[model samples]
Target chain A: DTAVSQTPKYLVTQMGNDKSIKCEQNLGHDTMYWYKQDSKKFLKIMFSYNNKELIINETVPNRFSPKSPDKAHLNLHINSLELGDSAVYFCASSQGAGNNEKLFFGSGTQLSVL
Target chain B: AQKVTQAQTEISVVEKEDVTLDCVYETRDTTYYLFWYKQPPSGELVFLIRRNSFDEQNEISGRYSWNFQKSTSSFNFTITASQVVDSAVYFCAPSAAGNKLTFGGGTRVLVKP
Candidate 1:
């Protein structure tokens, strides 16, 4: 079974379009996170949710928001997509926050904002 | 605030060669965690290993080995007898207070057969 799964492995949209990427983990973990990998393959954390509560929010733009309705799911929604937002986004989950747990990551969603 | 840096951008080695990826990190927390992840062309990030801040011991698992030195704040990974299947981008990361991972600019390894 896939531990972490996400929808729309690839997304192609124009500027000003709003889109969402859904993520789910079956590992019954308590913490979920969103990370962005830019063209240079630089990975940065964007958000983190522990048991559906927001824990860490990085310096991402306001257009990007993450919602975790439950402990098993964390979704990212981007509004007014800009060219700079084009990158691969990965969803990950861990056992808990600051508990020295290894993360299980999804296959990632490659978003292209034209 | 924690940061991780992997100096080698990309490395290409022939099969059966030994390859190492270097990682340097900076953090104020006396107790923290360091991790290594492998991302293949398929785009999935696979967890490799994790080391604690206080443990400077070197570890070996199968064909993989990790040498962690706290004095230099470096956690290095070495692959013995590299194979084509070993081709992937390796990331070194440090954990913040909230378990937030700061990943280094990955080092892509391409082992040609």
Candidate 2:
């Protein structure tokens, strides 16, 4: 069974379109996170949700919002996508959202805005 | 701010050869966690190992070994008798607090047969 899964493995939209990527974890983890990898291959954290509560929100724009319906699911919604937003978006989950617990990542969603 | 750096962006080696990937980290907090993840061509991130700041002892598992030195803030991974299946992009990460993870630029390994 897959531990963490993200839907819409590939997303292609226009510059002003809005889209959402959904993530789910069968590991029964309490915390889920979103990460963005740019063309330079630098991975950066976008958001984190612990027990469906927002724990960390990086310097991402307001157009980017994360919704965690429950502990098992966290979805990312992006509005007014731009050319620079084309990158890989990964979703990960951990047990307690603590320091020691390691994260299990999904296959990632490749978003392209033209 | 915590940061992780992997100096070698790409590496190529013959099958059955040994390779070492270097990772250097910087963090203000005294306690933190270091991790290594492998992403295959399929683009799925695979968890390899994780070590905390307090533990500096070296660990080995089968063909994989990790050397952690707190003094130099370095966590290096060594693969022995590497196979073609081992070719992938390796990422080094460090987390000081919370659930956010700061990942290095990633090192791409290509094992030639």
Candidate 3:
């Protein structure tokens, strides 16, 4: 069984379009995160939620929003996407929001804004 | 801000040879976690190993080994008797007070027969 999974593994949308990527974790973890991997393969954390509470919010644009309805799910919604947003979005989860813990990552959602 | 650096962008080795991937991290937190993840052509991030600030003992798992040194703030991974299947991009990640993770640019490993 997959511990973490993301839907719409590949997303190709036009500029100014809005899209949402869904992520779900079955590991019964309390924390979920969204990370963006740019073309240069540099992974950066965008947002993190612990038990439905916002924890870490990086300097991401307002167009990028993350919503966690529950501890097991964290979804990312991008509004008016731009070409620069084209990259791989990964979903990760951990046992808690504490430090020194390893995260379990999903297969990732490849988003390409044309 | 915490950052992880993988100095070697790419490394090539012959099958059955040994290769070491270097990772250096910078963080102010006294306690943090270091991790190594592998992403092959399949594109899925596979968790290889995790080391905390308290554990500095070198760990050897089969053909893979990790060395963690707190003084130098380095966590290195080595693969002994590497096979062609080991060809992949390896990433070093660091986590601090929160669940957020900062990953390095990654080191692409190519194993040739």
lDDT of 2 by residue, B38-112 (tens): 988988888899998898899998999999999999999999999999999999988857856889999999999
TM-score of chain A of each: 0.98, 0.98, 0.98
DockQ category of candidate 3: medium
Compared with the true structure, what per-residue lDDT tens digits does model 3 show for residues B1-113?
88888999999999999999999999988888888999898888888988888889999998989999999999999999999999999999888778567899999999999
Candidate 3 residue-wise lDDT, A41-74, digit = tens: 8889999999999999999999999999889999
lDDT of 1 by residue, A1-114 (tens): 989999989999999999999999999999999999999999999999998999999999999999988899999999999999999999999999983789999999999999
TM-scores for all candidates? 0.98, 0.98, 0.96
lDDT of 1 by residue, B6-103 (tens): 99999999999999999999998888899999999888999998999887889999999999999999999999999999999999998877789989
**What is candidate 2's TM-score for chain A?**
0.98
Model 2: runs farther than 4 Å from truth? none
Give the runs in model 1 whose Cα sits over 4 Å from its true position.
Answer: none
Question: What's the CA error at residue B94 for candidate 3, in Å?
Answer: 1.7
